[model samples]
Target chain A: MKYSWYRLDNSAIMYQMVLTPRAQSLFRMGVKLKSPVVPSALKCAVDKAFLRHPFFKSELKRGFFRPYLDENKLPFIIEEDDGVLLKLLDFSSNNRYLLRVSYFGNRFFIDYFHGLCDGTGALEFLKTVAFYYFDALGIPFPDKNILTLSSSPSEEETEDAFTKYYRKPELGKGINSMAGGQAFHVRGKNFSSTGYGLIQANVSTSALLDAAHRLNCSVTVFLTALILASVAEAHVKGVPKHNLTAFVPINLRKRFPSKTLGNFTVFAKIIIPKDCPLDFESLVPVVKKLLEEQLGEREVILKLGFTSLMSKMPLFKFMPLFIKGFISRIGRTLSTPKQTFILSNMGKIDIGENEVIDEFLFNLNCNKKTPDNVGVLSYGDKTLISFTRKIVSTEIERIFCKKLASLCGEVKVISNFREECNAL
Target chain B: MRCKNCNVEIACKSSVCPLCHKPLVSDGEVPFPTPATKKILMGKFSLAYLVIAVIANIVCITLNFVLTPKILWCVPVLVSFIYVYYFVSVTVLAKRGFHKRILGQALILTAIFAAIKLAIGGNHWIFISWLPAVYLVSDLLMLIFIFKKKNEASKYIATLLLLCIFGAIPCISAYVFDLSVKLPSIIATSVSAAIFIICLIVCRKTIIHELKKVFNL
Candidate 1:
């Protein structure tokens, strides 16, 4: 019998190459409902949602040249949430599914392996699952705009957007400017085990927007500037001064206009030199300007083209899988020191004015090199800015919260480290 | 609900601020549940096994030296200890696939037995009898696994193919070293080749598909 399979996307190849047992490229996006979750309803809803999205019913398989997604026929099992933020997804234990869906109390989370899909794609899946869940609960869903179980899977949803928009550049022409030398690395003792210390700061969406508007910048740029300044203030006194850079992932769908749910995002490296002003107000323009330079249409297209082109190079195409994986792992390690932290703003998730849902949560997994990362998602007046770190020190998060409180008036914080702190 | 030290609202119901670790003024609901503690005891248990194995090996060696310096009974004891530790840690306790653990155990045991034979300067029983028998058992186990989990044949076929390659190694080594007992090696190589041929004929499409997926050719 024939089976459905797909070539790993241009960006997913990198994720697969650098994937280790320790460094699981995982991230979570979840929703907290007003009432406790029903296990039977969630299981039924997940089954329906799994059938709806055929693209997500596959597993990553190692190929001779590169990894590919093979159709997985294993029964989809919805697990009870074990209270871990971004827990490792053991493929053998998870029946080879790259993504996991689990519920705890009123919240249900979908932790996705980056090789399967990026955050936007995973959000679409989450919304669909949540929509089916509410349906199973016999509750009315206010949002008809989101993808539901009734929607049919489309071929375009699985297309490689990076390859689709690849415009060959002129011969011998390359990017004029590149990200400069090594950014300052964050220092802290890692967690005792493989888990993240999560701190979610809930603030009003309008308040954050108002603060960003006052600085004449977007919310992402404003937050990036704040984080850079906070890192500088928190670590500069003790450590050697170095340039601070934040990697902000920009969704390519907005500019390229593709509905592909595959990995189709590029990052804009916003660097603040060691000598630059460390205050929030002065750093905004620098961030805004640098963001603009990297996010330009021509620059993004060039990057997309080059990335896709590199994957298609004869040397890369013919290299054996193990060799390619080794090379990519080395490449990732070498390039990791060039960035300080990752700041991913998932933008606003409009689930409509659904009375049953309380708020949305977005959490990112940090690696050993960059121990602290941020994930932001806004839903229904509440914008949750989450700090997921592998380290113990909260000095950077403390400074960031204090600065954010001064701007947003009030910031409500929640964390998974309450037990640890209480014991201490 | 608010933490004065951090100047932020304590959304969770913890007694102290998550950031500043200071007392909060009022109580609130915790948004996230406490994470389940990990199984760190398994790691400590493995370490304990290692310590015991080391002490046992040291005592056995010292006793062998004191009691019978002419004899080398401690060699087998050391090998047995090493195999026990490996079996407990990697085969029994490691978080890996069932097939991987079994295959790994088979390979390690074969190497250990071969090393013992060489260390003792024994006869060619290792190559003529022991090696062939181990290869046959491993090949049969892989075949059974493939047939039992036919739906997941793709996952097992690559390993089976690897076993076929390993099966040929003993035959080739026996010839290269010119061991007098060549009939067993010939019989083992023939059996392996015949099994491979049968697999190729019976599941030709699957074998080809698995190779294409594996090689991406």
Candidate 2:
């Protein structure tokens, strides 16, 4: 009769609050292996990986006060990939599991509901599954750093890092005081249907790194600046330019040491004023300065602490779950208009030194308000920048690839809209 | 392999660049296979049904206007058409759980029956027979499902609880509207109350655990 359940983390609360049929906060991480995926082997790999990371074998349950994760006893089945990017998961049809694993051709994909974990956590699970997949095939992996089936999961792995690292803020000093001004929203006609269109640009990692180094900024900053410049160029002529803000998610595990496999990330709102230079060269330093200021240890902690404090307030804590969910949806809707786009960089992903995987792919789902979102992931020599959009216009994507081609010399483009392109 | 207009290498085997739509200069291996075309099951059938329903309604409305405009005989036909469409889509064809389908059909039927009774200027059978009968049937069906899927009883408990809540409505309406025939409403409420009490007594631990999981702060 008793089942294990977990209280959602502070960051996860926001995700649960805004969860709707239209705005399902879902993201995907996948890898393209050298050989075609064997279904039986992949199934064995998933079963093996589930032992080490049993927290992912859970479902979202609506609690009286909030939503919690309940242990799901249903079999974790690996479905065939449907090719639609970031399709919404129907919990009832999916046996109430919050995550889905599917394979197509040589690629294996894991699409996770954002309430389950952040990108870093999902990447760990994906790597572990891949490691076991190769192991099931009787192939040896070169690197042993991956969490294997042999090791037991640690208690720290399931801890709510936001609560663990939350420090009481000094009186009246640590409250978030950022301006609530609205950012320039990307406007265009949406796709007639309800799925996302993916456009991935594969560039040489070394070339991108060198370009970023030349700009005296990290790859994330460099790419963020480039995207800002692209958005500026694609801005319709004769319209008043508003400030562009990029919602960049920063992984907290790097700053504060915790092995939380739940949601343990905060966002940095990097705003580029309209009057500021919109050129790529000029945007680099501006983005760098803004990122540095917002990404500081103190600032990040303060933001996390403020969120923790808000979630724990007696008023919100005791409120009924349905009312809380209603308020959360409203808050998300009101807050979305203040941002232009999202840029989530998962940084370098290293599963092992094996030659099995050809590349890694990461993608973020777009919402009605923010119809354009980008996900970046680097593996081996290839850095993939995936643009997931709900809109039909590819002007932003076109300008982005053109600029990257001019910078990196050659950018390989792959898309699901090839048929649409032929018609055009 | 290269697209001159976009100045980027074409990764897939498509003839034109996905971004700029310019023809590529060289052929290359496709990294991603073409996505399988999605099959829209029942799309054509649904469209045909909708077209037929629209035409039927239009003909009926025109006939009513010409033959007996003051009576408005087409209204019930329109309501029946709407009810049939909802019943087919949600209860019959929709990929929903059995519990949801049963509850949905029960609620919609009850509403339609009540509306018809009210339209005919009668309210006695609705309170004494129709409403209680619908609630009792829904509650029994939910209980059967819970028992059939005993191992996964937790999954169906919420629906059962919802049916019990609906069971109270007939009794409440009887009192609120001061209906003369109170026996059927009383019987429905008592049955629902007994079921609720029995569930608490028999599966006390499981019910408490479920409640805790649902209401945890």
Candidate 3:
């Protein structure tokens, strides 16, 4: 049966692995940031990264992992715009992924969707470009954090795992409709300043992996436990319990060849109920078990089934109106899940300090679309625990930076969401 | 599908109109034409927004298990409906969304949630209840549009609030009225149904009539 559901095409598929979802605010970067904005050196680094690893140009092999535009047949594959995707907002801050550039007074929106690459992979690419850009600018780049997200040695080896699963969309009962609708939250500009704080920690990818192994959890879970602990501590002022949906995006790379430069990640969600008496230590075992089981072959099969259903033939192509409506109605419920926030660990992005590629990938920043309510996470030689929040006070970023410094060895907090580029 | 802004008569399959840089137009119909040359989000945003609202209501079932407020958290739950209304009002259906419609949608959802959570108050069985009621609201809204004015969905906005406020009311009233230790499902359903019928009739005779007379409908 055909439905007037969202369809995709080659453009959606072309830069598939390169697409990254941005927070809506991030999208407005082009319109937001005051311009006279020149392309930053970070952008040049991006040009260079593309030099090393030109995006893998593969045809649409199957339905699952191919870059597919959302219901809106937007041309660009999704990726973060460095203009808004900055480590620190500077004059020449045209920090963007290879394709998406939202600088100046516009949204830092990477005019792409989430069919190309996962947050982890995209961050790797972004950091690589930034590393090169910063080194050239005479800014001392951090240690060469070797890229940890490994590609399957060969496409043939991963074919079975990739092919075994089908797209399976798990959702509640049907609300059959198609078409992108807008329900933008009206933020209160008049929101009185309430003291909220942020802190970023740089836990090396290796150390995080170690913690994950010891805790019997994925690096995501271990880091989540830590974040949860921190939140528990920070909100100790009669901590009002809040239900948190930690949005976790997972790359659907097993079925297809490596989408080395596309947005090809799906949101794998975890719900943490507020006020639940979860001891920090106890959560590790449960999270470890969940991670171990979730990545199994069966899980992928289930996920693929949902993906297949979602990728149902476009209603306008051949299916009758009634059939199309029926199928598309089902598709909508099949796509969404409940979660409060997104915490994706783009595992590790490495940049060598070699003279040729002096500074490769430097610091990490959340997608412009990533809300301050949201947290963009990654771990390499150092962990990047960044938050995208609305600032009510100058001390919010200051407090978070201080807190992060205490959590790990040497940590720096780059305050781009607010006034100045002051690092304490 | 041609480009909306420019006279560029590109392929029905093209995303960018050859002459003008404009989004491809769907001509306000489903079964949008898609060719290899162009990419279109064949799905309608309004429809997706609608679907999200219904599923979101079902997700509210988590409230039964998790510690949370019933009403306030319900506000966040209404975000989907707000989006749906926004789409339908501005884009798909093309009309100014009314406060009553928003209120109605919210109330219907809240009541569905309130009823379901109450049914399986403790046991895991409660989550199932929200789904059926959510389905009912969406289905009934669609069906009602057939009988009432152009958009009957708005007509029942008041009733929806009544449902949320008085959802448990019948039960409470039954207990208060000394109707019975256990009020019959038929009775509660019958009473609500009666009120709804009465409300629809009154609407047709009054506000709707006024709308027609006032706007020469």
Candidate 4:
């Protein structure tokens, strides 16, 4: 049967090509409510939200040239599975939803295939669902500031923003390129035997803000410096400290004026030299200075432009999916050791006038390469800093959280270690 | 109700907490409601497939009788139909499991090979030459489940051994049948054996662990 689909955009194509069984390109963005989530209410909320957002209603389909998102025919049911981190999306199954809604206790988590959308797109869908869910639960939500269900999906919402903003390739110029070098690799027993060791450390937003104020930097900058210091201290023998670079994703929406919900994000590397002292005071200034330099108009343009140029090239566009996938896999492996770890701070999301949402938590995927990742998000008074790792050693997470706890008094840490979800 | 262990509040009447699976006791209102059963479209697809297969088989049989009376071309058509039916019913229709699907594929391959041999009048060579090779490949796959630790090095060693066996069997059978494909078989066996020996030397520690697990020592 014929299905309506679109060519997988550049961001989406990379995810499809580089996915491995051991290292599925998957991440979880979650919401915790003040009260427990009602299953029927969540289903109702999902149904209403799905109608408003066209992206969530679609599934990935493998085409002759590349994979594309097709309209899903099966029921989009909310699952209650918590056995593994991000269960691979099986498109061949009767239900081919790219994103899965799973609930445990008061938490509702949405796991994405990375091909569907990025963190910003995911948060938009989650916010709408939370709005509808509270409304369905007899608790009315104010529509003034909340992202309520739209009557119709705007064409702009589903447009490929990369195509809209891509510029023609310049013949001769130095592209904004990150230096390739080995960084400190976190080594531990592979938790592939068990599942991913999930640890969420919740700190007071006010305390973090106060700490950031004292440091004269943003919360993300302060936290990134703290993480860098922790990793520097944990650095093993023989690894050069000069090569330590923390990979941070910079959302382009702040710079670019478009609401198109495909992947519109680029990465910046925070590099520190080996001779530099391993302390927060020493690293914070360097981080702030580098971030200022990296986020410059010229630098950001070149960084984003290079990716768009690659996708637009006829050579890459016409290459078979497997060949592209193979190249991407190799590229990821060679680049994986260049950075210490990936830290994504989705920033604050306002779940307006809804008393139900307690906080938002973000967690990155655990892969064979660069198995440990940190994700941060804040809502209301709580800022959840989550650590997702496939390694048995919690050294990095412990060091990072201990530093965070010192900065922000009384941090609450929770874990899913050795815990299994009860089957329904 | 709240889990004493995880400190997360539970909203179900079931004494066990859903998240950490710890026990809890307290009268708490059900959080939302149990989700309704999803309406899957598998039944509709199966019904349509069944209807198409039935009609096609009948039409093929009728065409065979009308087109050529002496040839009995319906035999091949019927064989293809059986293969499709077995694949759909065994693999697709049944509950999905990794081992179950592998077993189903093996059974289907065996049936297809047997049918082709019969259709070709006397190809005892298929059972002697190709079927064992296919079985050796499937057996390598089944070893994944049997060992439970799929990442172990010994499984790959067994896979390489089976690869060589796959090469050696065909060569031996070809010799018995006096066929002309001996040189290619020897090359396959030698290459597989060399790879296997290299892997054994490189991953000795991992292979030892795998062997211990297998022997239960």
Candidate 5:
């Protein structure tokens, strides 16, 4: 490995020592292939791809003060535990691999502990694995433009983008917009089992495309509006006339030029003022405008820089880890009320041209603080919306899917719920 | 295939939902990916600890030999080394089946400590007196914890009972060994036994419930 280890980036510190069973900080990306996935071919693909991205294969170790990643001799092995998806990872135990690859039928999914990488980095790794899987299947060479084990990893891919892109903060420009009243949280009976409830709503991409086009907005904005509307109806009950913000993670790799497979993402809040009559029609324009404004290079840079600068401070860096962990836990708790829910869109996954992959889906664990999360991803002609929640109620998902179905005239909702609890 | 119960599209070769384990009828949908092997290349933290410990012991032995071969101070070094190994293995490495592991650890520690005392020309009282007293206290605490139920009032009652018997060993040892400094042990045991009697009266119902849960009546 070129680098022994990098310090846990500012973006990842919030999740490091304060992890609970309820908040494992895990997310998954699954690929559904056209043909029955060959186990040997998949294994070969992983083994080959592992060489190119050895950073993901490294194990996390508890250092004297902070945690560091140590290189492991064994590659991250794939498990066939289809019984429970996104299972809790105990980093201290024998299973030190930060990543897990699981297979069911023609579906292959990689569950990543977020400390390893963000959605963008995880997606990039999975795309490469898919590329080699197709190659192992003796499929015709699709496209030459793809990341493979042959390509030597660059220093840029392993660079700490947060530190690299961090500019000295201007005195007056340091702004903290994390001021908001408590949100109307979604409450329900928790699952008897610790596993999250998943509702995978597969919408025709063309239908969603048309809806976004009509709204003069992107799919992400359109979906955010629908979610807000659904949450308002199903969970919030009544408008509290306060700031109900939806925290969206913007992948810095999109705006900045860094390919490190660690956390290089920052959050931007899209606030839906409680004063407004919350409706899909009105919220679409607001969400679109908010995203456009926050997605700017200058604003994101400042926000991310502020975080990076704080971590770089000598006083903050010198503080004992236990104290830092305590402060981080408190910060997380205080910040929870500001965000109504977390929505992450990996946008679209493209392995290569003429690939046999039929679809892709993304989902996240329901954290202790934020009990609900919606992950969006698209593959080919299908858009997979994974509504992962910790509670027994799927009212928000049902409402959101029903709204999308109303627009598209068809929507397929699949869930991991055992009981026909929430009747459609 | 789709699960009728969960309504989740099962990408499984089996005709059942992995989540709910409900039967599924094939709608001719393809399954998800399959892995090459179920076997994992497991990481060995314990093995790493063992290797480091072995290397350190070798270094200590070499230093002892270089200093003075006749004295062989490496013997105590070896005992201390083994104690460190037992500490890590019992506390850090093992996660499951703690009941057995903990008892095994207690036995090993007692044996190691007794051997050290004997080697240093201490009296047999180290084994007969000190070791048994410590073991008795630890074993009682362990049993209380092992029997304690989640969010139970009986745990507090058990704590009270443990406190009552706290000085029983010191007082008994003093009387049996015919020690002159028996005043401290007598006072401690009297106070403890008195408090224990008070708790047995005050927390009678809670103690009964705890006993029932522990004995599975």
Candidate 6:
């Protein structure tokens, strides 16, 4: 009967495109990671309150997929329509849990689509949902472990007035205009984690960064270069061509808003230079530098410029599908420095475990299983690098882990990787 | 695309260094090509448009023939006109406002009818269908031009046009079928009202004009 924020519409954007069967399959596999049923009280509270939020209660509807597009330049709310809301509610009713989850059954997870939210926003919702469950259960919950920054010199959130009014309007278009010109990015073929095992190593945040610095690299570069070397050594061996790419998650918090958590993290790929020495020792330095440049704000600006221009061209209105495919293909062939796998290093997650129980468990539920090969690098009290590969061989993961381990000292390889497993 | 060492300047697509034969992306890439998305969507949308228009036209044709054989031809023309106009107007308005091609068609149709009406003078072929034609054309234009692309302005225009058409449908059908049909002026009004309601409902989050903006169109 009522939707809280819909009365005031802050525009939103939704991008839809087809994924390969492999991509679609990964999502289904992802659903298998149904954490335990969450705390009973917390679960009950969330279930009750979830019904109040329109996002959870909403369902997919049929229309020209255009209206839902928030071209107002910012995420604004829309006045909910009785008919549309009713239809969405009806659709969502069948799968309410899709929007909200009892994280880990014990953990909290909100599986929002990336185009709609970034890691910053995702983490915000994650913390909010956890507290919602706790308060609902009438349980004694401590302060939510969310980080908020006071106004500072080095710390900046995406306060871009331009993007605030800039709703990536082209994204709002109905799958129209997708590619053209040097859309600066390290092109990559997504490798799902369906059949891969995770290779993680826990290093003190200080130690981790120190090791990276010792290797003269950043956290992202060290991890990616190591993974690339592992992959090259374990799988690509003597092969002339190693279809290797590193899909790095670029956090937009600095340029975005402190509270903004949506899919603001643009995917910047760093393809290991094709002819480089495959040994882990040789690769780290090269990758360290690439990751730094790839995520630079200027790089994003340059890439966006080309993509924006392409979208504005009238001739490309009906050209996205063709363009995206052609680009992706060319990306495969000519895309050097291509993206092979993504290295998501959620740099040291320090929520001060001194107050938490049995230390904090931080695992990135990529919302859904990614079709792209991925290594989720998170360092809490423990550094766990979970690997997923539907497209590549798991041996690469082994070598990658070994390389990471070698950075500190040496890593011990463990196999028999399971899809639904999580190591802290 | 870039250098491996400094990575600052432009570089050639090769294995060795141009300025500093460092490497493109250490890992060798083949540059394989794949099919594109535009080809897929064009095929998909064109088919959707064709199917929807054909079915709608067929329904109109059947209804016209069954109700009144005398004004049957008008059914196809009017219905087809509506279908064609939808995407066309949406597309043209996206680039520029409605003009030229859109209005020219109306004038051509109007003149042909005027010539026919003068020659046969009012009574030939049951001229009542002409009333709906005038109502449809005038209303559609006003509805389209009033909105300045993606604002609430277009919705009202859309609402108005939809309502006008809702009213014209029944009357036009009756006239083309050559049947003596009596409908209150309120009928036209209520029809338009229903269309407005539907537009509000269907186009809720995804209005086309707004969509163009999101895709940078």
Give the count of colliding residue pairs in each prediction: 2, 3, 104, 3, 8, 88
Q: Could you tell me how far off, in angstroms, the CA of residue B94 lies in candidate 1 after the best superposition?
A: 5.7
Q: Give the per-residue lDDT digits (tens) of candidate 6, residues A68-186.
A: 22212112121211110001111123232223242232223333433234444444444444445555645555543542222121111222222342334334331222121121122
For each candidate, the alpha-carbon lDDT, in order, equals: 0.81, 0.81, 0.39, 0.69, 0.69, 0.41
Better of 4 and 5 by DockQ: 5
Off by over 4 Å in 1: A1-3, A169-179, A188-190, A237-240, A273-275, A418-424, B36-39, B42-73, B84-102, B173-181
Q: Mind giving the per-residue lDDT tens digits that candidate 1 earns over A1-424?
A: 2347777888998888888766778999888989998989988888888777878989898898889888888787888876666878887688889888888888888899998889999998888888888889899986455776556778788888888888875434545444456778889777766567888889999999999999889999999999988888888774446678898998999998888878999888887866777888889999999999989987788778776875667898888889989987887766755678999999988767778989888899887778889999998899999999878888899999999999989998888882383222
Q: Output the lDDT of residue A278, model 3.
A: 50
Worst 10 residues of 5 chain A by lDDT: A415-424
Ranking by TM-score: 1, 2, 5, 4, 6, 3
Q: Which portions of model 4 show Cα errors greater than 4 Å? A: A1-4, A20-22, A90-94, A168-179, A237-242, A330-337, A419-424, B1-217
Best candidate according to TM-score: 1
Please give, for residues A1-424, the per-residue lDDT of candidate 5 as tens digits: 4654445666666667776655668899878787777888888888777777877767765443455565666545676744455778755442578788878766888888887789988887887888888888888655444667668877777666888888866546556443435665666777544456677788888889999998888999999999988888876656564566788888888787787878998878898767776888989989988888788777787787776864578787667667877887888766655677889988866655665777887988775456679999887778988888776666777677667877865676566542332311
- TM-score pick, better of 4 and 5: 5
Per-residue CA lDDT of model 3 for A40-77, tens digit only, reads 55455445544433332111212222322121111223
Docking quality tier of candidate 3?
incorrect
Per-model TM-score on C-alpha atoms? 0.89, 0.86, 0.40, 0.68, 0.69, 0.51
Return the number of clashes found in candidate 5.
8
- Tens digit of per-residue lDDT, candidate 4, span B6-106: 44334345465443445667565433223233345657756787788789889977987898766656677777877776677777776665555665676
> On residues B46-119, what C-alpha lDDT tens digit does candidate 2 reach at each position?
78878988999999999989998866557667778878989888888888889888778777776776566555
What TM-score did chain B of candidate 3 earn? 0.23
Candidate 3: C-alpha RMSD after superposition: 23.7
**A235: Cα error in model 4, Å:** 3.8
TM-score, chain B, each candidate? 0.78, 0.74, 0.23, 0.48, 0.45, 0.30
Model 1, span B129-149: residue lDDT tens: 888887777777767766677
